[model samples]
Target: MTEREPDSPVAEPATALGRMTPVDLSHPLEPGMTVWPGHPRFEHELLQCYTRGDASRHHRIALGEHTGTHLDAPVRFVPGGADIARTPLRALTGRAAVLRGPAGDTEVTPAALAEFEAAYGPVRPGDFALVDCGWAGRWNTSASLEPWPYVSVELAAALLEREVRMFAVDTPSPDPSDSRACPVHRLLLGADALIGENFTHIDRLTG
Candidate 1:
C-alpha cells in the first residue's frame, strides 16, 4: 500500500471545550417592553399566520437600534466616528470581568473599581468590563422610572486606562437617566470602545 499523506492541520477551538458556560445576557424583545423615554417602542406585527390562511407565518418588527440590550457604536455619540458595521467583532466578544455595583442610584467610582480589584482580581486589557448594578431586576416596574445607577466619568477614564474593550451595565445607560451631557457615552465612544446597555442576568456571571 502507498504511504498515506500526513493529516491536515485542525484549527484549535476558541476556548477549551467543556470549560465554558453560556449565559443569557439579554432581555427579551417584545411589545411594550421597557424602553428609554421617547425612543421607538418595540413592535411585532404578524404579517401572515395560519389563522389568516397564509402558507407561512412571519412578523414585522420595528424598534430603535438602542432598544433593549444593545451596544452603542462610536457613531452614536461621536460625529464622523465608526458605526456598528465598522466595529470589529473582537471588540464585542471576549473574556468578561463582572464588577458588582451598589443598588439604587449610586454612581460607580474609581475607588469602587479599586475595591473590586482588591478582592477578585484586576480588570485586564481587552476584557469586557460589565458592571452589575442589580438594576435589571426593575425592568418594566415603577422603580424603573427612578434614576438608575450609573458610572462616573472618573470611572470611565479609569476603565479606558485599563484598555477595556467594552463597558457594559445592567442599567439604561452608563450615564444617569436624567443626564444631559452624557459624558460617559462620549468618552467611551470617543475611544472607539463599545458600550452595552440594558443587560440582564449579569448576576449569574459571578457564580
Candidate 2:
C-alpha cells in the first residue's frame, strides 16, 4: 500500500471546540479514491433539472458500488459469502466496551491482549476488540493507512478460540507492510470477525 495524493477536500477548517468533531474517515469516491491496481474507476455526471424559459435548475450526483463508509460482507472477500441484505440483525447488535492502550504501540501481542483483558475483565466468548494505535490522526492523508498495525497470529487465534465477535483498530490496515499476504485479515476477517480500521480520536474512551 502506497500513499496517494490528497485528492479530496474535507470540510472547511477544523472545529474550534477543544473536543474534536469526527472527520470523515472515508475517501471521497469521485473520479479519485485511489484503488488497487485493478479496481474500477469512480464515475460521475451532471443531470439537468427542470428548466424554465429563462433559467434551469441544477442537480449533480453519481452512483457507486459500496461507496464511502460501506459495509463489506464476508461475501465480498470469501466465495459465496453472506450478502449484506442477508446479514442477520443479531449479528449487528452487541455491547461495545471502550478500552485504552499505550500510545504508538503496534502489533498487539498475545501477552498484551492478556494484560488488557485482565485489566478490563475476562474476555467473554463474544466481545469486540478495539486497538487504539493513534493512527486516526493520519486519516486525512494516505501515508497513515499504508503501514498499519494489528494482532499477531497467536493473538488472532486466541481471539477466535475465545469466540470474539469482532476486532477494530484505530490504525489503517492490520498487518505489516513487508508481508504480501495479509495474515491478520486472513486470521480475523476469514474467521468472520469484523475489522474497522482508520478509526479516529479513539482516546475519547477515557470519557
Candidate 3:
C-alpha cells in the first residue's frame, strides 16, 4: 500500500506473502471434540483476542491426539516414552504414496494388502505410506470418526514386514472399535514404526 499524503489516513505497506495451496489433514480440537473412548477430552479457550480488546487474540487448546496433523512417538508405546518432539522431523515430513485401497473396511487384513505389493512392488524403507480406506468422505463429526477405518494387526505387521519407515492413515485412529484395546497400535508402535492418524484431505491426493 502507498503512504497517504499529509492530513490523510496512514496506510499499511503491502505484504510480500506468496500464495500456496493448503491441504488440511487435522481435526479441529474443541471442548466437545470427539476422541476415542477413554482418551483425553479435547478443549480450547480463547483467553484473549485482539478484537476483544486484548493484546492479541490467542487461545489455548488442550487435548490428546491433539486432533489433527500429529505424530505418534516411539516412547508413547515404550516405557518412559520418547514423546513427539524427540523424533526426527525427517521422519514425519517426506514423499508419500496416497494408496487407495479398500473402503468401509477398517481392519486392513493381510489379504487386502497383497495386491498392493503385487501392483506397486515392495514398499521400501523410509517411505511415507498414506493408506486411504476411503474414509475421507465421512469426517464431518465424531460418529464418522469412530466407524471410519483402521489397520488390522496382521496388516500392521505386513507394513512393518514391507519395511515402511512411516505409515499413516486418514482415520482418527488405527483400530476398529472403542474397546479394540489398540492391538493394531501396539503392533506397529512397539516395532518402532512412525504412525500418523486423524488425517483429512486424503481424497485430494488420490488423483
Candidate 4:
C-alpha cells in the first residue's frame, strides 16, 4: 500500500455514511409577500398556464432588490461600492455562528455578544456572525413592520474589531426603524463586510 501524501486533498464526509439532508434557509417568494415598508411588494403573474392550453407554464415576477431574506451589497449604502453581482461568494458563506439573544431585546449590544462568545467561543476572522433575536417569527405581522431588534453601532464596531466577514440579522434593517442616520449600515458597509437582512428560521440553526 502506498502512503498518502500530507498535502494531498482528502474528501471530508459531511455526514456519517448516511444520506445528507439539505436545510432551506431561503424564504419562498409569492404574490403579496412581506417586504420592507414603502418598498414594492412582490407580484406573481402566470404568463402561460396549462389550463390556458399552452404547451408550457411561465411566470412574471416583480420585487425589490432588498426583498425577503436577501443579502445587502456594499453599494446599498456606500457610494460606488460593490453591487450584488460583484459580491464575493466567500463573504456570503463559510464558517458562521448565530449569536442568540433574549426575546424582545431592542438592540444587540456589545455585552451580549461578549457573553455569547464566552459561552461559545471567540469568533475568528472572516467568519459570519449572525444575530438571532427571535424576531423571525414575526414575519408578515404588524410587529415585524414596527421597530424590532437591531444591531447597535457599538456592536457593529465590536464585530468590526473581531474582523467578521459579514453581519446578519433577522430584521428589515440593522438600524432602528425610526433612525434617519443609519449609522450601523454605514459603519459595517464602509468596513468591507456585507450584511444579510430579513432572515427567517434562524432560531432553528443547531450544531
Candidate 3, residues 1-207, lDDT tens digits: the string is 576578976435243223334577666655775566677877788899988899888878777654555778777667776677778776766556566656774566666567656766666776677777776566556656556666777778877876777778877667775644787777777877778876777767742
Record all residue pairs in model 2 with backbone atoms less than 3 Å apart, i.e. clashing: none
Give one digit per residue, the lDDT tens place, for model 4 in 1-207. Answer: 698899997666665335545556667887777887789999888999888999999999899898888887789889998887987665666767778756674778897778878877888888888778888888877788777777889989988998997888887888887888999989998887888888777777742
Q: After superposition, how far is residue 90 of candidate 4 from its true place, in Å?
A: 2.9
What TM-score should be assigned to candidate 4? 0.88
Give lDDT per model, in order: 0.87, 0.60, 0.69, 0.81
Provide the TM-score for each candidate, comma-separated.
0.89, 0.64, 0.73, 0.88
lDDT of 2 at 148: 60
lDDT for model 4 comes to: 0.81
> Worst ten-residue run, lDDT, model 1?
9-18
Better of 3 and 4 by lDDT: 4
Tens-digit lDDT string for candidate 2 (1-207): 666579964455344343555434344555665433344555665455455443566646654444433444656566776666776767655544444544553576777577776777767777766666666666546666465666578877887887877666666455665667878777776777766655555555532
Question: Largest lDDT belongs to which candidate?
Answer: 1
Where is model 3 poorest over a 10-residue stretch in terms of lDDT?
11-20
Query: What are the per-residue Cα lDDT tens digits for candidate 1 across 1-207?
Result: 565467965445765545777888999998998777789999999999888999989999999999989999899989899999988776677778778888987988887788778888888898878899999889877677689888999999998999997989989899988889999999999998999998999999861
Model 2 ranges with Cα > 4 A deviation: 1-72, 98-105
Query: Runs in model 3 with CA error above 4 Å?
Result: 1-22, 30-32, 38-40, 178-180
Model 3 residue 65 CA deviation (Å) reads: 4.1
